[model samples]
Target: MESSPLSALEQRLISHLQVLYPQTDAGELARQCLSALKLDAKTPSPQPHRNIWDQRDIMLITYGDTLRWDDHPPLETLHGFVKTRLSDAISVVHLLPFFPYSSDDGFSVMDYTTVNPSVGRWRHVSALAQDFKVMGDLVINHCSSRSRWFENYKAGVEPGASYFYEADPNADLSNVVRPRTSPLLREIQTQNGIKHVWCTFSHDQIDLNFENPAVLLEFLSIIYQYLEQGIRWFRLDAVAFLWKTPGTSCINLPNTHEIIRLLRLLIEHKAEDAVIITETNIPNRENLTYFGNANEAHLIYNFSLPPLLINTLVTGSCDHLKNWLMRMPPAQQGTTYLDFVASHDGVGLRPTEGLLTEWELDNLINTMKRFGGKVSSRTLPSGDIKPYEINISLWNALSGSVAKGPDQWQFARFMCAAGIQLALEGVPALYIHSLFGTENDHDRVEHTGQLRSINRHIWNMDDLEHALNTPTHHQKVFEAMVRLLKIRRGQPAFHPNATQYVLHMGDRLFAFWRQSLDRRQSLFAIFNISDEPQSFNLAELNLIATDEWTDLVSGQKHEDLLGKVTLMPYQFLWLANKVGKLSEPN
Candidate 1:
């Protein structure tokens, strides 16, 4: 790229960079960014419109190597599969940590710029981008110890040595919040001397020091590279662990928020449609702080929703889930929740701290165990260890079955979760495993010894094609979910940013009402959380049959009749009726 003449806006951006890095030589860095983006001597691209994420912006989150064929690079196969099987249903595909990594299933990043050879090359990524918007994982909090940056730091390399955070071995770190119970600092033999460097995740994943302008500059470079690769959606992995400072919780600090805002600013300046979603698996209120006046993240993972939704299905009650949703603060104009039922990681428990009672949590835990799910723990600030997450496939987690084969109730239970996800007030995301009704991969877990492995199975192309083609649980769930999503995509009432009202139907029923942005379309989605039948009265909510209501899910016209409305075991109904009055339409 040529170092072209700078636009005034480009000059102003450079000045801001200079202010950000007062002593460092930021002129060249700024010029490089401007050149890389090819910003002409004119106004920058229009700032991304928030309207891009509506009913149609459904996302499919998966790994590059999740599907393999004939030893071909998995990314190629992933692109082919998504392009063929999921193109119309999904618009955005989040390729989780496709870069070269050492451990933690690609979380411990060894390289940032290049794709893992085993997965495929940049062309594969570009190929997927051609079909759907591609989201890249920016493992920003820490980098692999085996990375060149870390090795350079060990050799006392000027820029790299200054990139990592270091603290005295005797320094007090009690206030530092721990995501894992691992050691906070690791003693390393550096070229300069013995050093105790901060490593919040693991010795292999050394935390980067954002306090250093050099580190921030490097990060800016990496992000620009991703932008060059056509990735517009960037998920900051384990962001709460970023920007650590002494004597603080070291999570969601003001400095951390500021850094995120700065990055958001840079991205918006270059590409308006680019997005940043923060990954913070903490309590709901604290997790939302990433929004930072709607300037920090365009989306923050609704970490609370997964566990709360799971608890609702597990206990056959909506008390916990309803209470949580009712109390949720409204999302700001440009920010919204990324609601998901399951992910590569298991169901997180930390997000349910205040939402679920100890007894309820225990009941949920034991229920998961009965279904062959494994539990992983985290160290609390109080120095006590407790279950942090439940590691299980959505299939096994819901059906309480550990058999290698499908459960009889698999499709019903899975679709119930998906319906709830779609009916929510935000952009609903589906994990690849969850979409296929995949079951536990105990063999993978035993072989890799990573509990999360049970839910992270890479499929053989032939086996996967067979499963998806036949009338197996996987095919049934996939086809049903796609059908639901298709219906959801067309309904203005299911708009991601539309206004939602939680409807309290009854003990076994969970419901929410959605109104379109234009106020011309509306829907009342109701779910039976238990196996038992549940019924309600339309008169209770001023809704009536056939005259003013139609069931969207089953296409059943609600004929005028008795006030009682009934739902079968695990059945869900979506009703569209008169927006307000229950009088006859005519």
Candidate 2:
């Protein structure tokens, strides 16, 4: 028999494991983890991991149970809908944690290995994978207390007994950055005795002890199992809190980044193209650290974009957004952002920390309240609570209630948000609620008594399809968005790797220019975020006076490019000199 191959991947895995789990057999555990990858040996796969994104990389973010079916599992229904409705328009489906959970929707995971019985089985995921790439959330920060591991710990089980952190109730943990106002420690009656375990998010979600090598190995096994099931895109949910060291902020700790880097390394060897997208909802500077010289995360959530975008549209000023964009680090060769306006949660306000002033941020909170949005707060080290996230659907949050204004007002503003999101220099991910043009789910919020329920609407797949196809508001945005994405994907200039130049288009207008990697295709995208009219000389944005331009959105020709073009409230334009050539046949 041939000797087991000793490759650099195995060496690196052993090194990481040795550091994290020195007491355990690092070499043996690394070998075990690598052995768990179930690649098909019958055929030579070309691309095991396709991490780099492109203009075609638009995604729909939805819970696996977002769409329901009484007769079959919801994942089956979701898979069918993606095939029928979204196969062409969107290329990826980010199915938020379909795993069994005890609380926090799907964030408090009960089992990492199996799909929730309520959602379909692994077969359903594989079915969808055949059509479009599916991005699965790996909630690595914490697990449900009701999980077997937690139960085992309560029963004095070997590895489980040492899997979680237990701290003294009186310990001073004031320096920790908390996402919620909940108490950090929870008293649990374990087999050893009654103890206070460090439960970061909630009492039910017990924080795992990454200091224990067994925990890291267990997660590695779980991740390898996911890779086996063809999940190339793994979204590390709440990754900033992955590793905890006492007497510190415990957010974005170096050990946490190291853990992420190990996972990325696993992907590099086992699944070459697998993407690790980190979700850090903290302020911008600390969040950007996940890039880690291109070895940590292939993508980090652009958390600042949602609030900043809303701020731009609400204030009719691009100063904040423009300043933020201009100062943003250019996308590295291997990494980019998963840019989004809203998600299953809400518009996070914490990300606006350094970007907006106290007054500007307060303006947003007040505006959200005026729009019937709810705010959730986080605890500070000073023991004061501050607003952290605004809970409401992106539609209601943006244009307020449709009942309050003309349909044009609502539609224009909604499309403008989408336009700016797409115009950003990253892959755009739209929440399902946004795509369906749904408003706040006040009924669900009252029924479930969960603030996030305001945005998390459950729908019957067939009903949503029929409802969104008609001339309803949902259908209007859906149709327009589809057209926009279809056009966006066909243009080479919109590639995520393209170089972007923030252009000066006065105060009310947001403009940017994108040039393709080969310099063959160039497109300038501009958005009018204000209610009032705004005009600018096309030449000001660098469209030469002699160059013939085409407005992709309107299909209008601009031969006299230097002339002024006035934008109506919330109008967006995509101008390209060689539209005929750049507009590829889809």
Candidate 3:
């Protein structure tokens, strides 16, 4: 009898295994990987979505328990809220880590296969997925020390005896790149005597050893469970630090990229429509590598967008923002960027490393402090501490400008930031708090003693509904955001992979031109990033004299291609030659 030939997927898996675990039997591990994918003869055939995504696909990022009422589980409450209020505007809902955890607000996951009892059961998650696409965090880098796997390791069990990365406390870890000020090696007493395990984010979050092929199989099974529960989008949380190596920077190591490629392969094979987004909060250049020739990371968090956009709004200059935008390579066919101005965590400063100068960064940091933002620091290789992120509410962060103190243009400024975000060439994700214009929650911060708590406001559903029904700024911002998102949904020019060109209209004004893929629609998104009035000739845009143009936001017609248009302080316009109406969700 002759040996059978390896399938294409098997060949690819073996290649990845060779790269990640060279000492192991690659062929045997490949078979084990295939088994983990549950790709049996009875497996369902892949049914990919007609379009992986389009202009109408807007993702709303929120915690499972962000909104609470009575004794109802937060997931149920969140489902009711979305169905009643946001179903028309948001096509996708990203629930940030709803798993049982020991600390770090769910990022330190204790269980990968089940829902947190406090949040609700997996049925509640499936309920939301019935109406909207659901996205979940895969917390791939580390797990809570309280997890059963860690306990098994402590007991010297077979499955998890060597499941975590260990290093000598005195090793030359000086070159290790991590985003925490805590000690990297945690000394623990195991059944096999003393051991020092690596803790990248926090002592409670123990790093898993991917060098062990068994750990990879465990996560593959977890991914299968998530797919069965109606989750097609996976956010690989803190993935940049996934692979560890001694005598190296230990961040974005080659093994990390190989693992991502392997995961992408298995995921796409399991569910053709499945999307994998890598949460790599690194510098711009390093961040771009996650794309991996369109084979890895169907989407990446536009990590540099928050700090750079906020800086532009506060400093009233678009030089840095424009420069960064121009250098960004447009995402290819199978991949795009997830753009946002704010998220669950703080505005990461690491992504802005080479993009912004030291003086510019310091000025931005000072402005954030003036706006009541807290700075979180990280330990450098030389034991020096430097600011890593700015923790503050998006509403508060845009309260005023660096040139002037707190002003009366807070609402306008916030809207301007959001408007620019929506018009960019990517899928726009709005945090739940940003929708309601929530301010910094000092009470929460004081209660939790965590800097990031300032932005994670837990709202009472009753209070949120009441505020939306009233005429408060919360109501105003919520209604405005919905309207903007609705408008974006119908425009082909706003597709995540549409054509984009940075336009030069001076430093105080940021402008971009977006054209539909089929070349039918052209939109000029211009914003006055200052606290004063600004005007420019429409002729500079070179609008076609034959076709009529209209401002999508105000519905005002522009008869003369050479006419002048004035934008008030913190104002923006979505001018287009061809108009698209607000589309209803399918």
Tell how far residue 421 is off in model 3, in angstroms. 0.6
lDDT of 2 by residue, 7-83 (tens): 65666677777777768887777766665554222223324224377777888899888898778889988887777
Better of 1 and 2 by TM-score: 2
lDDT of 1 by residue, 257-294 (tens): 76787677678777788889999999998998898887
Question: In terms of TM-score, which candidate is stronger, 1 or 3?
Answer: 3
Q: Estimate, for each residue in 1-586, the C-alpha lDDT of model 3 and write its tens digit.
A: 9978877677777899998888999998888887887764234434432249999999999999999999999999999988888877989999999999998889999898889999999999998999999999999989999999999999999667888999998889999988999999999999999999999999999999998889999999899899999999999999999999899999999889999999988888888888999999899999999999888899999999999999999989999999999999999887899998999999999999998989999999999999999999999989999999999999999999998968999999999999999999888999999999999999999999899999999999899989999999999999999998889999999999999999999998999999998999999999999999999999999898888899999899999888889999999999999999787864
Best by TM-score: 3
Q: Rank the candidates by TM-score, best first.
A: 3, 2, 1
479 Cα displacement, candidate 3 (Å): 0.4
- After superposition, the stretches of candidate 1 with alpha carbons farther than 4 Å from their true spots are 1-49, 400-408, 544-548, 577-586
Selected candidate, larger lDDT, 1 vs 3: 3
The CA lDDT at 489 in model 2 is: 76
The C-alpha TM-scores of every prediction are: 0.92, 0.94, 0.98
